[model samples]
Target: MSATTYALGAFILLAYTLEAITGFGSIVIALSLGALLLPIDQLLPVLVPLNICMTGFLVSRHWRLIDRRLLLGMILPGMAIGTLAGYLLLPYLDEVSLKRGFGVLILWFAGRELWRLQRKAPAREHTPNWVMRLATTAAGICHGLFASGGPLLVFALATTTLDKARLRATLVSVWFSLNSLLTLAFLLDGRLVPALPQVLLYAPLLLVGVWLGERLHRRIDERHFRIAIYALLLITGTLLLVGP
Candidate 1:
């Protein structure tokens, strides 16, 4: 195998491992880190299957813990509308510029998260339905464009609850639902068939990562891990914006 292929597998392993631990980070982390090895277009279509399989495993494992009300009432419609809108807009967009813009946006998001943590801001007792809807919409747009919308979705969910298991389960449920649609779209577009073999090659690594991640989940300090992730995302986003 080529070095790029090897690098891609490593990123997949890391991304899926993080997903297993946190519930919804595979795509975001992969897109951020894989930018160096491949363009966004090549990376996304190939990663779709991995995303679906890993997220499906998570959803099945945590089916009972998902917050169904939040899934149906807030996440579904907003993501549907936003994703559709983004898909419609894709043909007109300049891919390179859009990617660079997204990189900058990601950096800002990571910075804001770090600042929020630094300030030790009090968690809001209640997040309005409209706000949650809006956040989900933004997440859907990110998914439509880059297939990396977990952070926005997580922002919306973080406001709704603090229970880790519920958060992970609910987020997995959302990713599984969205990723299934994306998988179908890829299949319809003829993207999946060509990439299936590559995806299969990485499947074992994805599974192993998930297994290892589940083991680490109990031992790691979530808060510290999250902070470290955000910091890493900031650096990765900056690299994306700067280019090689």
Candidate 2:
């Protein structure tokens, strides 16, 4: 393989490890690093398959932890509709709009977390119906647009009853399912399959990355873990919005 491919493969494998272990979604890790070496067009297709495979692995490994109710209540309806809309409209949205939207989403999420930490927001409450309704819908809208909407949903999930590890698992699992569905839809529309050769070629690196991410997750505290994620989101959002 070429040096670029090898490097990206290693990068993806490391990202996967973090997602696999901590239950954090891999979209940002994949999107940010993959951007350095691969086109966003190519990266999206590659990540769909990786997410599906990783989800399958996690479902088997942590099936017991999966939150079926939340999956159905918040994710399934909101995400499915949003993805369908994205699939239909993604081709038309200008890059400029996408970047601006991404910036808004990132700043909103990051700023909220920082505010929460400073205010020492009291013991978190269950996701109210209205909050879930709004957050899930917004998350769906963003995910459909960019395939990088984890921070929105992550904010919602982080404030809930589940502990850090379980929260991660649930979010990642939902992401896996959503990506799998989106991939099949993309295949039907013929937007991505022609590139499957690269996907097949890079499979090993994907798996290795998941392994590493999982290991790294175990070593860090959850609060710190989340801060790192928010920091990355901030950087990604700004670059996408303001970069030439």
Top candidate, metric lDDT = 1
For model 2 the local lDDT of residue 239 reads 73
lDDT of each: 0.82, 0.71
Residue 152 lDDT, candidate 1, scale 0-100: 84
Q: Pairing residues by index, what is the TM-score of model 2?
A: 0.84
Model 2 accuracy (lDDT, Cα): 0.71
- How many steric overlaps does candidate 2 have? 13
Q: What is the TM-score of each candidate against the true structure?
A: 0.94, 0.84
lDDT of 1 by residue, 182-236 (tens): 7788788878888888888998997798788888887998778878888988998
| Model 1: residues with Cα > 4 Å off, grouped in runs | none
